[model samples]
Target: MKDVIFDDFQNTVSESLIRHKSILDIITKLQESNARINRAIVKSVTNCGCIEVNAKKQNTLENTNMDIESLKTCLSTQVKGTLCDNCRDVIQNEIGNNLFYLTSLCNALDLNLYDILLKEYDKINTLGKYSFR
Candidate 1:
């Protein structure tokens, strides 16, 4: 059910990648797309004033008895407010562009985007809280 869309999207990306067929171009474009996403997010905060980041040091505690769920409460999304319609639309488009470049890079490397996603999902699911640490 899930992979139906991913396969379709990957196929579409493979067909759309005309000018940036080279691996070098794909990688660089992927990075550039990422940068654009960051800029779009920052712009939503600074220029559009739709969202603001209330970032600070995380409340990570050293209590050996603290459960992972409890530790999770100490973490914050570090963001305040919500994006307005225009900002939301802009951010979503930038993210979509980033995904396009990412899929393009995967196609250039002869990789399956869905397979990579499944592998990552399996790793995180198996490792649980220890996935990142």
Candidate 2:
């Protein structure tokens, strides 16, 4: 039973990877965005702005950080690595929850997530190299 489920999961992931270029593109962009946001937040806090003025911006940055963290977890689950049955189920659940969270974040931020993804895809396509980092 465990083997059957693992096989099915692998197949599902494989098909998704082949059908949707956005998955990899999104993962890459999320990583880059997270790093950039973190740096901006650090700089904002270090500049010693008034609390009242920085509070709202800080809150939004924190929320965006959380969303990025969730997206990272979702991307990790998509990695092709050996896993047991329990780990596989956990990864699947994490992926589902993170994806939901990311979608909500996109709506909240009024962001066209696919647009970001497509842009990333174009960059990768032009480079002809997968190693962006």
| Candidate with best lDDT | 1
Evaluate model 2: give its lDDT.
0.46
lDDT of each residue in 36-128, candidate 1, tens digit only: 989999998999887899989875666778788888888888888999999889889999999999999888788999999999999999999
How well does candidate 2 score on lDDT at residue 86?
A: 50
- TM-score of each candidate structure, all chains considered together: 0.91, 0.37
Query: lDDT of all the models against the reference?
Result: 0.89, 0.46
Q: Which ranges in model 2 have alpha carbons more than 4 Å from their true place?
A: 1-81
- Backbone clash total for model 1 is 0
- Cα lDDT tens digits, model 2, 1-133, are 6546544544444344432245455465456555554444343334432111223222333445455446444332222334455544544655554454354345435565556666777888887533334
Least well predicted 10-residue stretch by lDDT in candidate 1:
57-66
Clashes per model (N, Cα, C within 3 A): 0, 0
